[model samples]
Target: MNFLALLLILKIGLSLALLVRPFMMAPTKALNNVMSLYGDNPLIYRLYSIAILSLCVAYGFGLYEALSGRMPWNVIAFGIVSNAGAALALTALNSHPKLRPFEATFATIAAALVLCALAPNYALMSI
Candidate 1:
């Protein structure tokens, strides 16, 4: 019920959504057509999803420890970097007007999560 535990739960949910995005949202034809520059393949997207899945697993463990009243600093640190980077990347991608709404919304979510995590907490180590 602590704030850190809540944050970890949010992060795990986000990572799960990201991991399934390619499979659920991007139809094969769209992927092939839009990313033809990448040789009409979803390989890169799949790899990225795998990476997100890894983060989800890490966040799950962090949440477990957090519920036990332990601060998982390393997982929190990794989450900060990953979420911040995703926010920045999504923001930049929002330049494409066609994708602006989705990209901007997720970017805002990621940024807000990072800000919450960075807030003063006795459990956290130095930023």
Candidate 2:
């Protein structure tokens, strides 16, 4: 696959992992880590998880469209912007050192998505 396709696949995979993380961590000490990081509000945590899952669904749809040869540039652009904004907001709001790596990784992924969305032809040039 080309770079664009690869990036889309990566995005979908990461989204799936993010969607599953809450469920997988719920019964473990990771939930406690989440509570410590996010606060004692279970509602907030649930809402956050729902938001991530929603984004994941959107990304999945985008990936399907892309693979079908009808790439949805608008959806991809939205994802890039939203992910970048989320990364920036998280970095600004949270000073937790442990979360920095995740924030940076998300920002990097967002940057890659933006590049793919903006210049798919150039991005896929090698193919």
Which model scores highest in lDDT?
2
- Model 2, span 1-127: residue lDDT tens: 4666667677667766754566444643466574345444455556666777777777778766666666668667887887798789878887777667768877988898878767877655545
Residue 124 alpha-carbon offset, candidate 1, angstroms: 9.2
Give the whole-model CA lDDT for all candidates, comma-separated. Answer: 0.63, 0.69
CA lDDT, candidate 1, residue 98: 47
TM-score of each: 0.68, 0.77
lDDT of 1 by residue, 15-125 (tens): 576445764457567665543434556667777677778777888998787777777767767766776575577566535454445555555545644665566353432
Clashing pairs in 2: none
The 10 consecutive residues of candidate 2 with the worst lDDT sum are 34-43
Measured on C-alpha atoms, candidate 2 has an lDDT of 0.69
Worst 10 residues of 1 by lDDT: 118-127
